[model samples]
Target: MLDEVTFDIERGKIREFVLATHAGDTVHTSVEAARDAGFPDVPATATHVVVAGHYRDQRAFVAKLGLAYDRVVVGSVKWTYFRPLCAGDSVRGVRRVAADTRKRNLRFVTLETDYLDAAGDCAVRVREVLIERGAQ
Candidate 1:
């Protein structure tokens, strides 16, 4: 099964994230700076912001798949950026099960998340591997 969710990339949120992360990059925090840098608007948000959103969308699906919270651990995460996600862009995340494997008492599931921009163009792809311990 696949799970999907959409999120709006608001300017305020981007600025707040920039401040919280101490990014010190004006382009990410100010529209004027981004425009000066040749961007149409504020530059793309920090990668972690999109990553957090992706995980938020995936949490419920993981639980629905019968994976207990305590038993599960993150194995790895990889992100590939195709294009910048500017402020005011609406992005959608589509997550699907990629692989499932069992090794002894451990079970591993790989999830692929495709992030699409407002124009429906793929902007980023994330692959996350999760491990469930003591699971056959």
Candidate 2:
């Protein structure tokens, strides 16, 4: 497992992320809508936004491991959300190397990341496979 990377869930960033992705969830952008939905604050962030950050953090770790980006492609991502992550929450992700296998001319690296909330509770788990072409 690699060191954890942390991020703050800012309301403005969440709103912008939803807008950029056209998530179509008003609760992600409007506090009023979230409150009307009975949330104490803005509801959980759009799932893709959280996953994107997790992917980015893992990519940085892969880079630090001296992996060349030009030969890498994302294979798959599976996400499990345990609970809602409201605005102002702090999220930290830790990456674990799940498996590495070579098939023909490609290498598949599978990784899992656990996203922890401010109270150190697991909020989400993401499993991703990255294919490295031309890997030995």
Q: What is the C-alpha lDDT of each candidate?
A: 0.78, 0.76
Structural similarity to truth (TM-score) of each candidate: 0.85, 0.83
**Residue-wise C-alpha lDDT for candidate 2, range 1-26, written one tens digit per residue:** 76567787778877777777777878
Error of 1 at 115 (Å): 1.1
**How well does candidate 2 score on lDDT at residue 118?**
79
Query: What's the CA error at residue 33 for candidate 2, in Å?
Result: 1.7
Residues forming the 10-long window of minimal summed lDDT in candidate 2: 46-55
**Which residue runs of candidate 2 sit more than 4 Å off their true CA positions?**
48-60, 63-66
Q: What is the number of residue pairs that collide in model 1?
A: 0
lDDT score, candidate 1, position 120: 83
Give the RMSD in angstroms, all C-alphas superposed, for model 2. 2.8
